[model samples]
Target: MTRILCIGEAMVELSAQGDLWRAGIAGDTLNTAWYLRRLLGPSHHVGYLTRVGRGDFSRRAVDFMAAEGIDTSHVTTDPTREIGLYAITLTEGERSFTYWRDTSAARGLADGPDRLQSALVGCDIAYLSGITLAILPDAGRAALLDALRGRDVVFDPNLRPRLWPDAGRMRAAITEAAGLAALVLPSFDDEAAHFGDADPKATIARYRAAGAGQVVVKNGGGPVAYGGPEGSGVVDDLPRDRPVDSTAAGDSFNAAYLAARLEGGTCADAIRAGHALSRRVIAHPGALVRAAV
Candidate 1:
């Protein structure tokens, strides 16, 4: 089985209801891991790598992963800190987050190089995001990059510029990370806004110049552009249909695309898989729609 390691944070998500909130597990990498495991079914082994506290919430998160068929063996226990928490509100089907994660235990995921190296033992693919890079301290980030040196890394510059100290630092880090990645998936909208790229072609060119071997640029309502040696495009034409929630759209797309491509499907098939899964996710609420999986 192909073993994939999703490295990042998973937080307790509270979605606003009429007077109360619904609690669940959600995060960029975690969402991808969940959808990846679901799509792959029994063929691939998916593991989440992060640190969590000994609190009940942390325990619940771990149990959630196990229930979702994800491996929790690399989840480290940090006695002093608990998992992060976030609240979400949907405004016209778009979601906004209020994070209470300053002391999130996952910030220490790369605390020890040796431990990270050990955990990578059986991993065939390593996946992470720009948010993962933002959460870590310099030392932790350095440790993570070191451990990822020779791995088949898949990265998404899920850009949230506000999280970084500055745009320059974020670019430097992202460029370095892209260089280490075998595949770099970036949203064209975010790329244009953050990097001043004029088009998806520019986004592809930028990442390739930064040393990424494969690049896929997703455009919300435009043609999805991808390039390695050749180029291809796919546009999402499915009806928006008054989305209940647009959360984790990119996350789900990433999962389906990766899962299909890993299973030897063609790029066109992978893109369609991504588009179909993303459409399904947006029609529901929250970052994850676990039921009917």
Candidate 2:
């Protein structure tokens, strides 16, 4: 089996549903792993690596991953801290979040080099995000990057400014992480706002220049720009009505694109597949939607 490991946090998610609140388990890397598990056949072994508390929420998160066929053997338990929680508020299909993760156990996920090396033992593809870096301590981030060096790493610069102490450090850390990734998937809006990328092409250029083997820039419902050694091109995203909740659109797209590419599809084919899955994800509420492509 081809082992694919996603390294990051899984939070207790709370999404506002009218008067009531809906609770579930989700996070950026976990979201991609979920969709990847659903898209890929049984031959692909998907595993999650992170630290969680011994609390009920943390136990539920691990149970949820197991229920979804994701291997949870690398999930470590910490007695001092519990899992993080975030609540989503939606306005006209746009989503914003308020997080309670200051003391999250995932902050120590990359604390040890031995654990990081063990989790990557036979990992064919290892996935991570800027949020993962932001949540980690300096030494932990360094350890993670060192362990991931020379590996087939896929990175999403899912910039969350609030998670970082300052903008300069965030940018530097993301660029450093991008250099370690074989493929860099970045959303145009986030790159534009934080990195001053003029367009999707600029976003692709920046990551490519940062030593990313390939770069794909996601532009909401707009055209996607991609470039790499294999090839480069633009693929127009399918036009659709306003979404129900835009949470995890880019995450789902990453999963679909990577899954297709792993199955030997071309870059253009992968982009189209990504778009198809992303459109379906935004058509529903929450991050882990029931999507097929």
Candidate 3:
């Protein structure tokens, strides 16, 4: 059995809906881990590596992950910090999020990568997001990158500009992350904003130069481009017919692609699986839609 470790924050999310609200847990890596568990079932083990507060919300999140068959053994509980919270506002099928996550316990998880590194040794694949690196202090980031040296790592540059102090630091961190990743999954808009890439091919070239064996550039509502040992090219004519909400499109796509690749699907087949899953994800209201696993 193969294990996939997802390292990042998991925050409580509240979404407004017709004078009422719905609550769930959501974060980039967490969302991917959840969807991966749903897609792979018991055959592939999924683990979430992050710290949470010793609070009710945190407890609920742990229970939820357990129910979803995600391994929570690496999830640490911190007494001092409180779990982070975010609110989602949906209007006409478009969603925007406001976060209050400055004190998230995940910030501290990065500080102690030595303990995590030992636990991660048995994992077949490790997945992380740019937001995971952005929340860490300089020392924590260094420790994390060092810990991931020889693993089949998947990097998603789920870039949130507001998380970084400046653009220069963001670019530097992303560049470093790209070099460490065996597979790089980046959104076209994020790559362009941070690295000044003009198109998907340019973005793939940028990551390939950084030593990534595989590069997948996710362009919203447009064709997705990919490059790997099997060769590189674009899979065109994939415009979302009616993209309901672009919330977890990229996250779900990453999960589906990785899952398919792990199942021995070709890069093109993996991208098609990614497109199919993302199309279903966006048709719902929240980040983790309550659908059949």
The candidate maximizing TM-score is 2
| Residues 1-293, model 3: lDDT tens digits | 98999999999998777798888988899999998998885678999998899989999988988898889999998888877899888776667889998988888877676687776878999899999999888998889888888888999988888999998898888888888899999999878887899999998888888888799989885798998776898888675757666678889999999999889999888998898888888887788875623
RMSD of 3: 1.3
Per-residue accuracy of model 1 over 1-293 as CA lDDT, tens digit each: 89999999999999988799999998999999999999896778999999999999999999999998999999999989999999998889878889999999999999989999999998999999999999999899989999999899999999988778999989999989998998899999889999999988899889999889889887773567788754556454544445688889899999999999988988777877887888888888888886524
Please give the RMSD to the true structure for each candidate, in Å: 1.5, 1.0, 1.3
Q: Rate the local accuracy (lDDT) of all candidates.
A: 0.89, 0.93, 0.87
Per-model TM values vs. the true structure: 0.96, 0.98, 0.97
Per lDDT, the best of the predicted structures is: 2
**What TM-score quantifies how close candidate 3 is to the native fold?**
0.97
Stretch of 10 with least lDDT, candidate 1: 232-241
Residue 74 in candidate 3, Cα distance off native in Å: 0.4
On TM-score, the stronger of 1 and 3 is 3
lDDT digits (tens) for residues 1-293 of candidate 2: 88999999999999987799999999999999999999999889999999999989999999999999999999999989999999999999999999999999999999889989999999999999999999999999999999999999999999999999999999999999999888999999999999998888888888888899899888887888889887888887456558889999999999999999989999888988998898899899999997544
lDDT (Cα, 0-100) at 189 in candidate 3:
88
Clashes of each: 0, 0, 0
lDDT of 2 at 21: 98
On the 0 to 100 scale, the lDDT of residue 123 in model 3 is 92
